[model samples]
Target: MTVHEVHFPVRFEASVEDQPGPLWKARFDRYWPAYRTWFLRTATVGRPTYLDCRRAMRQHMPELVPVWESLVDLAGGGDVEARFLSLWCPPPYIGGCTQAVWLDPTGHEEPALLRNYDYAPALLEGNWVATRWLGPRVVAMSDCLWGALDGINEAGLACSLSFGGRAVSGQGFGVPLVLRYVLEMATTTREAVRMLERLPVSTTYSITMLDRQADWATVFVAPDRKAEVVRQAVVTNHQRDIEWPEHAKATRSVERQSWLAARVAQPGSAQDIAMALMSPPMVQDAYQRGYGTLYTASYRPRSGAIGLLWPGSEPWMQSVADFKEGQRDIVFPPPPAAVGST
Candidate 1:
């Protein structure tokens, strides 16, 4: 097992308003079918959100209709697909996501989502453009994953989704695909929570989200539709403070959490917090190797200041994104590239 950590320095012009949500829909139009099929075979969920999302795609993006339908035959679960479609709709209430909006501790929620991309293609095709073959305009950018590990978004909405080490395998469930959905479809913590509730998820795992604004929270969903939250503020690997079933025999999430807590407190400066979050240690567990233990981020909304600390690799990675005037710079070697058009 290998763990890789990457830092992103996002630059946003004051002229740019809120990031577009339809951009995500466009991405779904191209990639949703493969993902949906994967989910039907692998994930578990309580509501029909996943099915609804697929329908939305079929109507809005006709090109993907066949691909989506073909997945049913490929997975040989057309009945499941039909069942999901029958119950899908907009949810009434979404849960709370753990998010910390650092308004400069003064007032500045203007910082945009800093883009960071990391992944293991063998586990998940790293070159996002590969998704484009599914259709024209299909691009997977600014995402992170180790095989099927976890990632953060351009909006600083980061998540560490893990397969519960416990070996309680259920029906066909696709986790990676659903994770992609969370990042692509949801913009806020509440929306992310709804995405989890409405969709079907395979396997028992935990998903954590942290927007650039600093708000952060974790949700643990089981294959049985029963969901719990790790409401103590932040989440690491294993889980704590929440009463949820463990997916495996041995989980280090608690140890990782303690390791991080000892390093940084809640009410600290962005720099100190980033440093504490950047520190890394070793873990013999296969699931965590190369995975950065401490992932620190600070957002000064007043000045649109965003910082990231990823010390998992030999040369610790650090960077800053100043959204005030649309400027992003990296302090580490092998600087990050400028945002490009797909």
Candidate 2:
């Protein structure tokens, strides 16, 4: 198998108020075209009104109101609907993540989370930013959307996500924003589960949450606004059973779930688990455009520490207590050339 390396440059910014004005501007300019295209295409029919989304956020996650308002201001008060749609509209189903939670049954070691975020190859070349929200002191990764794909909060809560192997879409918020809400508001896996249960997600998604107390839950949320909590340590794209037949047939969820289950059943140290995330079945190859393992992140909630790894670089570790604001560039293996392209 060929290995394709992709480089991601990390940028750290203080609270929403402190982020560079130009930063938001550049992001908006680059992604607005794509965002508009996606919105027009997916939300043409059965789309939720702006008022509906606002009401849902206020009713379920009032804490994010101020955050959203701040984002609106940063967006220069233009295309307000577009901004809200980014958070409310259902994005195209992007899958291919393998996440697991390892709890020390003896309580002698800290619990850890391992995950590989896979998506379209175009996203790999996009400007992905990792911001540390000063208001809540949360560190998270996001793209053009102002939602978090994964993050760890100062409260020692860590959260990550995978596309639920389903084709259903509904009248709820995007899962990425929901993940951002959990990291900012919840302090334990139990609390996170509560928020997941309450908030309505527009699509099916699997969220794996771990906290400092070694408590964890993998919740499968459907578009119908129902959520099921799994106590097991491993989760892939699918729920307990494949609810979406077409999606199941298209993805390798069965194989990946089995691979993760077999690996977690064995007794291993934290390093062993982390290593497993960087290898096959977990770390995916570039099978299609924008569909490969972008990066693997390991979070230790007990210490509020996070380590990031890619195809080549050594693991980089940072903790909330000792985080320094700066930027670092990561270079990844280039994608394979197209069949007939020069």
Candidate 3:
């Protein structure tokens, strides 16, 4: 295991802006080639599903239209809407993550979120970014795909997502986009739950949200557009109960869930919990294979602060009071081998 100290700079933009400017353009351009390859291979084949998701976005959250349009203009024009829609309806991809919310826990000074995002090792290199969308003033960490994986808003609403442990794909939006929508629009756990319920998702996902009021909910969403809310404090990849047999057999969802439940049952401070996530049962170590724990993020909604840590620097903390102040790059450990090399 190795670690590198890098800064994560956040960019702010308003919806009224015609374009995302040159920096954003460069980032988008760098990601476009790979994105286009993925889009053509997966989403383009499901045209109707893509259009349906597009319609759903238009109907359910029209306010986001301007942002999509801005992305299109930034792309220098070419069916960017379709490409954006493709992100909302991505091809099936397997991911592992563990997330939990601590509400009013003893010795826990404030409400906090503990999360570890495990994915392809290559992604840890450059695709991940943190941004503060000025239009709605949301501070979030996202990928080259332009959808938020986790974030908090100025209103003290924070949320994160975990794979729902189901492989079924349907006609709906991606979880990341839905997360972005919630952070951008909702101010409370109830409002975030409502958005999760109303939105049509193309895959299975569990979204855990926390607010400054100490309210939290883990909403389990399916490909069929069915959503059920579980008011539990911990969540892994699967729902409370697994419905997909193959998915259940394949993922460590149940094991991770049990591990989290037991850890939270004992009294611990926020730091203790966050540190626990950096170890076994939480921190996965298959970096060369692309299923390793890339980063762990702790969001403190009450104080509007974020702390980030990776494999080697668990005891040390990198605190960001405001994500909009300056630019920083979070230097990452070199990939174990060339990505996908056998």
Which candidate has the top score in lDDT? 2
RMSD of each: 11.1, 4.9, 5.8
In the range 66-128, model 3's lDDT, one tens digit per residue, is 767676776775664455643566666667788989765464499898898877655532333
> Between the candidate structures 1 and 2, which one is better when assessed by lDDT?
2
Model 3 CA RMSD to the hidden true structure, in angstroms: 5.8
How big is the positional error of residue 16 in model 3, measured in Å on the Cα after superposition?
16
Runs of candidate 3 with Cα error greater than 4 angstroms are: 1-19, 43-46, 49-54, 124-134, 244-251, 314-321, 324-342
Better of 2 and 3 by TM-score: 2
Candidate 2 Cα misplacement greater than 4 A, ranges: 1-22, 43-46, 80-86, 105-108, 124-134, 326-342
Error of 1 at 8 (Å): 22
Number of the top candidate by TM-score? Answer: 2
lDDT of 2 by residue, 1-342 (tens): 334443334332332323436665666666667766766675545665656666777787787776566666666655544445347755555666878898765667788988888775555423334454446577777644577788788888999999888777776778888888888788899999998998888888899999888888999987775799988688877887887766554556788788878878788777677777766656666545444666778899888888776654556677766655444454333233421111
Sort by TM-score, best first: 2, 3, 1
Ranking by lDDT: 2, 3, 1
* lDDT score, candidate 3: 0.68
Candidate 3's error at 116, in angstroms?
A: 0.6
